[model samples]
Target: MIDKLSWMAIYPEAALLIMACVIALLDLSTTSPRRTATYVLTLLTLAVIAVLTGFNAAAGKTIYGFGGMVVSDPMGNWLKCFATLALMVTLVYGRPYAADRGMLRGGEMFTMSMLALLGMFVMMSGSNFLVLYLGLELLTLSSYALVALRRDNALASEAAMKYFVLGAMASGFLLYGLSMMYGATGSLDINEVFKAIASRQVNHQVLVFGLVFIVAGLAFKVGAAPFHMWVPDVYQGAPTAITLLIGAAPELAAFAIIIRLLVEGLLPLAIDWQQMLTLLAIASLLVGNLAAIAQTNLKRMLAYSTIAQMGFMLLGLVAGVVNGNTYNAQFAYSAAMFYIVTYVLTTLASFGIILLLAREGFESEEITDLAGLNQRSPLYAGVMAIAMFSLAGVPPLVGFYAKFAVLQALIASGQAMHIALAVFAVVMSLIGAFYYLRVVKVMYFDAPLTATTVAAPPDVRAVLTVNGALILILGILPGSLMTLCAQAIVATLAS
Candidate 1:
């Protein structure tokens, strides 16, 4: 029998699973263009779960449950809370677009998203390899189905097949890596693996071999270059709503798993992995930025940009520990965490605008499709502009500060290579800016492609406004969030 303490640690997850089931059942009996009742219920459930996760974070005490399979700490709880908010915002922004594409004919979009959130929650809280893998599969499986939801679209079907094949291969890599570690350490528990490695009881060669596969698997999940072949195709092929769904929220989960596996479970092997991460960061930055400049499609451009942004995040990870010293670990990891959170925020708005511009028969997917958007709707134009500028890492926006923090963390390491890496990342950011600014120019300067006069629902308008404002607000006042991130990392590391 599970004890009360263990039950409390997973209450939010339990609630989400039950509510997802309830919403799926309820949707079967309703028939509306937006799936109004199901939409409302899903949003409400996410909000309630976000509150619960916030409260859990506030409690500030780490709780291990299910015989140490899951551990709820401030870091995980905070990630979970923000992930729920991201998902909720995704649904709100996606509903109209999904409806326009005939995807709202059923409630699978909302239900699968909720299930994906549950998977993220599990990933955030999981302290064992099996639990983490289970969570990942749950999320990926739902994502595959969501991508194919529009069965009539040949591109959607193709995207689903590509995602499924690539995702399965990545899973195999991760599982094989885990099996190697288990064989070497004689344990499946992450903490025990950490202990075994730290005590120098494990085979270093085997561990290094496994680390390569694990990093490859993780790099695939995050769309890091060399493993990023599927990203542009999938992003352009899937429905925009599904694209946004895939793009925004899973990143938070990806960040969580990186922390859990690399920091918590494999810190003793920092030297080996950090070098790998550095290579990944450089390759991602070079490939992603350069490839993005050649893309005519907005979704594909953003996909390459995702790879580059994740590269910046990896820079933070690489700077965490040096020479077997973890003194700078908190700042480094926290900077990565902040970058990913703010990146997701900007991505939500970026894709939200794309979805808004889409209609029953037109998908505003091409960069030219955004021409003269300013003339049609300044509010949306401004939102997209803010998103574009933020993504480009321009000053007085959250993305700038996120890059600043990571660069600071890199330079603070006082290593010549890290400093050089920081400079390279900056140059890549400059190159990336050209493409982002082009989108803004098209929106403001180019002639209108049509005179449809883009009109968005009030709720979408409100969310976009808030989303744009938050980018500026967080940039101007990043201290509080930075402090929160630092504290979360410190608390969890200490525990």
Candidate 2:
């Protein structure tokens, strides 16, 4: 009966895929300009799906589809919500820019966007290596095309090529790692791999090597340092809309990959990956923060900042594994999830502002581009200031609390290095503050780049209203979201 209750739970994910295909078909068949209609319909579809997912969660049923490959746990539910919200914000932000640039291409853009969302769905629900890989590929492929949508822009073309080449190499490493793991355990199922590893006590060095490769592959996807050479370039070169999409989902998906494999499949080999993550985290912090300071381009700066954030998330994973307490691990995981949510909102909001200033054939990449913005639109300047403060982990902002919670988890577990890294993270964040504030300084102090304020499309305005309010709202009352995060981690990693 549980299996047969219509299984409408997965409709949220299916809606995205179905919408993508349908939009593509309609575009090819009819040359009518129903672009706004497509946008409205797409947003509506996602809204309905979000409502359904919420309803399913409230009903308290564990819904799985495709023979246990896609589990409907709280982790899936939460990430799905994050992915959808982020995409919605991007659509609202991008619609005007796309229209102005004459690049919306109506159906094509909508299709790729939804396809990327579907890829995110795969990441959220994937319970096996095969499903995870498939999902990741779908997201990567869609991202590549979206980046190159302009076709004529040299930078966009270059970004797509680099992304494709690097993405292929990462896939190769991941596939090789999966093959090695299969060789060691004679199984591809995560549950079976865990049981086998737990039951046997042998030095399976081959499997360990596979773990290294697998983690390397995942780090590449997350754009973590030492595996992050491609990040700034891609983020800088991709269309701003595509950059927004890439930033939102891939890191969350990478985190899921780590949770499923490192936390479950290789638990007995804890010391190994924990040490690896610590070193990786430190490298990411140093490289990401140090490199970001020199970037003149806003998108590239944010891309490096993303790398820095990934490093912080790994701090939580290392804390969880090394401390050897289930509750501590849960706290660490919950902290990481909270941070991800915080970062996603902040990142989307930041990008949305960038879109506001951006127009066709006039992409605003330089920090100088925003000179004298505060006087032009005090509201935008204020909202952007809060976003910057929050991103820098300043006090009374949600970003600060996210970092604080993780730091507390690390110190409470008595991990000396974790505490040290948090200190370093704070320092790098201080270094990062210089740039985030530069945007603020330009807005507040410098003369206006444009004497007249630009007006945005209504959709963009509506989206900003929610996005701006959310950052402060979260900072003020994070308890509810924090509780939900804690519960989600519990549902995902059953002890």
Candidate 3:
């Protein structure tokens, strides 16, 4: 029977849901074009959720609720905390852009985003296949609505349709795989499935078949190549504000589900899934880097860059098990966690600049649009440069250390194949640097298209400044965050 402990485990989620409904109703009375009342309440709600999750994460205790269908653990809590903050930042950076584009006519953007975040929380906390699938659908459905939020835009309508059809297919793949696992193991619970597989009582062929579809679904969610046909289009076609909304926080949820499903639930099948992840990583790097190099559109370029970055993150997961020994798992997974966190930080700052420049009718979509950005507004340019440099894995930036940590994890595995993958990843990063630096070059060296200084709301300016500074500061002092990630992973593994 459900008890207080079950309710305690999900207090933050409950608060978010309640507040989202309240904000939707509150918007009816808000006459302000910017929906200031709704926006402030939403931010306050997210802040409270972040603080609550942060405290829970720091407590470092695992709590199971809803008959173990959901779990509250350090890793999940920390991820939820970060996701909350990311969403808050996305909303802050996005609001002005949304207001200008008439997308904020109602409070659907704010309410839908909160609901999407609630979905992410569910995904991260889910310990059962059915719960996880429900979370995934909630997130995807919200995303489809968000992408098509601007009902009058043809590009948005097209993007929404594509995302819906493709997203449905991916969901089917994941659900089918989960059903097959249940058929084989006679359980929907992750731990029970793990135990069944470890006991060697399941049909190996059926398990492998399910595993393939599971990996495919996960790859699609993370925007890995061969299943990444939707990323660039959606990113470019969606209103810029909505693009940032979908691109940033959802990644953390994706990583969380991957850990819950593959590492936690199916560790016994490590060899099979590891092989699939390696292939996915390699293809993601190849396609992401090469395609990004040819892109003139900044959003599309970043989309491909995201695919490549996720590939590097996957390398950390690939190194988690060596010869079936899980000794390296904590460090490897922590590296991935750290990498995703830093990537989201950098993405926020980069996109914040794009949103700032996309004033009213002027969409700063092309790389040329950033020409002489330094001359127009050095502050935004500097933020964008830091983001680009970090993304390129340049020194004294978070991205460099993020890449280094993952590479270190790979090399420590002492496997020749892992080492070779590390080397290949470095080569791809070298190729990636050209495109990132090209943005910096355009910002600094090229002539300005117009001499208008970029103006931003005080809130956006403050947040963007801090966001960029954190990228550089974290790069210089990464030990604390690294330790936090390690501790979270250790606690999770112990639990």
Q: What tens digits encode model 3's per-residue C-alpha lDDT throughout 1-495?
A: 679888988888899899999999989998999898999999999999999999999998899999999999999999999999999999999998899899888999999999999999999999999999999999999999999999999999999999999999999999999999999999999999999999998899999999999999999999998889999999999999999999999999999999999998999999999999999999999999999999999999999999999999999999999998999999999999999999999999999999999988878999999999999999999999999999999999999999999999999999999999999999999999999999999999999999999999999999999999999999999999999999998987886
* Cα lDDT of model 1 by residue, 300-323, tens digit: 999999999999999999998977
Q: Which one wins on lDDT?
A: 3
lDDT by residue (1-495, candidate 2, tens digit) is: 446532555667777777777767766654445477778777887787677666655554566666656667777777777777678788878877776666665577788888888887887777677887888888889888888887778998999999999989998998899888888888777777788777775447987899899888888888888999889999999888888878875667777778877876777767778888888888998888888889889999999889988888788787786644555878988898898888888888888888898876789878888888787888777778888889888878888888888888788677677778778877877887887887888889998877878677777876786787888889888999899888878877773
Q: Looking at candidate 2, what is the lDDT of residue 30? A: 45
Candidate 1 C-alpha error for residue 393, in Å: 0.9
Q: Which residue pairs in model 1 clash with each other?
A: none
Off by over 4 Å in 3: none
Q: What is the Cα-based lDDT of residue 248 in candidate 1?
A: 91
Task: Give the poorly placed runs of model 1, Cα more than 4 Å off.
Answer: none
Alpha-carbon local distance difference test for all models = 0.94, 0.80, 0.95
Rank list by lDDT: 3, 1, 2
Pairing residues by index, what is the TM-score of model 3? Answer: 0.99
Residue 240 shift from truth in candidate 3, angstroms: 0.4
Answer with 2 or 3, whichever has the higher lDDT.
3
Worst 10 residues of 3 by lDDT: 1-10
Ranking by TM-score: 3, 1, 2
